[model samples]
Target chain A: MTVNVSVTVNGMRHEISGVEPRLLLSDFLRDTLGLTGTHVGCEHGVCGACTVLMDGHSVRSCLTLAVQANGSEITTVEGLGTPETLNVLQTQFREHHGLQCGFCTPGMLMTGEDLLRKYPLATDEEIREGLSGNLCRCTGYQNIVAAIRSAAALRRENA
Target chain B: MKPARFEYVAPASVDAAVETLLAANGEGKLLAGGQSLLPLLNFRMARPAVLVDLNGIKELSFIELRGESVVIGALTRHREIEHSPLIASRLPVMSAAMRHVAHLAIRNRGTIGGSLSHADPAAELPMMAMFYAARLTVQGPAGRRTIAAKDFFVDALTNCLEPEEIVVEIEFPIPQHDGWVFEEVARRFGDFALASIAVSIRRGQSGIEDARVAAMGVADTPLRLEDVERRLCEIEIDVRMPDRFCEWVRSSVSPNSDLHASGEYRKHLLGELARRALKTALAAKGDRR
Candidate 1:
């Protein structure tokens, strides 16, 4: 009925005990760990609102079981940066108006991080395809693409 | 949504997994990527008494080029295959299909073994398995046995796999295809295709040595159009071959008109998409030569 999971989330090592085998990683982060940045939109894997990095690979936390993530590393949206200091992607998004209602911003930011790390994001087409998994009903995605593009360029420039 | 409470076991080895699965006596469900299975559980479509977690069985997670085929462990992730240079140089068609499986996030976690076992009628992997004439190796309490891809799929979200058996590896022959292409018609990118077709031709000195044509989302499972392949092999390669191939394809399929597209429309598109897919495959084959 209950399972134990020892996971390193956002560089903090925590041993969570008595976790239900059915607990979703999304709920575990938001409810159990008190890290509510990870949103759950469609419960099904469609909307990428609950995206998180498990061992550096982006996965749908809503689709991932909390017990399944035992002995793994997870990075949620809260791991990226704090309100006082925004990360490079957050800054770019703010400057480019990536979020309007902000319901999909957390997912958008985490997906952006993974894309920036893995892909070149050379063209708008590439950026659009990379972000296809995550949807934002607001802002029309034109600015999201722009923000990721700018962030990609800035990353390249700095490198 | 949360999955209903179920017993869980993390087996560290194949023998252990098989033993645990055997103990469940067909009441157990193996969790590989959990991409497809987890969704089903959350929706309450499937409620297995035991969840045989196979992630800890790291042995079933490698890609190796064997003598004449690429031997892939059942736990190998789609993302690994998508980015694999060996798959690129050896099993190129698989690389092409990987981009369409799901978003990068899902692909990063979804496994080919799980996909094949799940056997979604519209899924790309099952279609690929049929296209490649893949051979699956399954391990059970009795012993290990191999099943052809064509015989593995039974119907929508169903397979010939016994509950006690787990798919261990898949063997895809290195195609010496003269031309090959995987084409699908999805409303949006990454969505389950309404209808998809994959074509490959193996030509000899005099004429066609071999031809393989397969389609997905038009029937209970991925259909390998044998009639289309034989006719294509018999005819002279030309612009008209596409039209001729379409006739064969349209006649062969048994499509169900779902909310997405009418069965009539699917049958109609079968001709056109199959034609284009065959043409593109032929062109690709010619380019390589």
Candidate 2:
């Protein structure tokens, strides 16, 4: 049976009906909403490629049913930046060459945004630990760590 | 992967939730944070006819300090416990073990009650609950009842709750032990532990007053090493104690062989991890003195 789900995605309120209870938030965002910036990797919770912010906290979009996010505010990769202007974390990812294949970039960016907002990110070790859930097969994670570290530094400097 | 078709119901109250489950009649599955359940659903490992979403029951999400116990609603998320200053000061061992639970995102959504109900032998919360001797309050058609952590676990990925019963809250008595430690070894930082050990020690004028040792990922369920604890209380707290405990731990558990590690490797880990945890806990006791 289909369920009615209303959610605010990237500050835009979406009231959708006939959403399958089995539909994943990842699929709902990508297919239904046409926000393909949020990529789906391992459908299981392990791969962080489908990570998104639900009410400002990172959650596995693939693991979350679309109906579960009914009344919540969600922020996908599309919410972060545009082709004309990039957010601080997105710019850092580009400058540091954090993406080799770009498959894991969206998840990495979302998770990075969550970490930067909440954690101290005082050390590279702390950054690595925070990024443990998200996996990157390329770049050996050195560049991703560099990107997040730089973004965290910028956040500290601005504060 | 996608879950098989299932009807969904989000009940606003615990009584309503119970009634929904009763109506499903053993075919309904309670959906908590969905950290673990969703994965199982996507894999089609669990195909319940109905999914009872419990997130709407706001009353089941709380963390309160009551007298000498910490009463945590079953829906309390792991991230909440990890950052709770009260948990940090009162149940430091549990706070320390929280980091070993999945990653930050999973922790944000994974509920303590869900973790205990899912009951993966390698997961950290089950071991912590068993270590603390926590009491779980559950509600069913017959009404609310309490179950000790020891009796709650029936086997791996299994709990003693009847199909219609739902966990309401868990009560952890703040331990009086002066020192405690939780050590785990996983292939990756957020992977399921290969084997882990937890130790809490109390010192007396004589030597050791009491001790509790528990091990996970080395048995069918999280184990309380009573024999090891008894031996620890009998022995003098000294250089040789860890070694003695290590040997005893090595012989105590019967771990399964999986793709992750051999039973022998898990046993080895239990021994070494136990030794390290015991030594660290003893040093913490010395610092307290």
Candidate maximizing DockQ:
2
Candidate topping lDDT: 2
TM-score (C-alpha) between model 1 and the true structure: 0.95
Docking class of 2: medium
lDDT tens string, model 2, B210-264? Answer: 8888889988789988898898888777799899999999988888899999999
lDDT of 1 at A141: 96
lDDT by residue (tens digit), candidate 1, A1-159: 798999999999989999988899999999999999999999889989999999999999998999989999999988999889999999999999989999898899988999998889999988987888998899889999999999999999999
lDDT of 1 by residue, B15-62 (tens): 889999889888899999999988889998899999999998888999
Candidate 1 residue-wise lDDT at B98: 78
lDDT by candidate, in order shown = 0.88, 0.92
Residue B142 lDDT (model 1): 88
Q: For model 1, state the Cα shift of residue A139 in Å.
A: 2.2
Question: Ignoring the other chain, what TM-score does chain B have in each prediction?
Answer: 0.94, 0.96
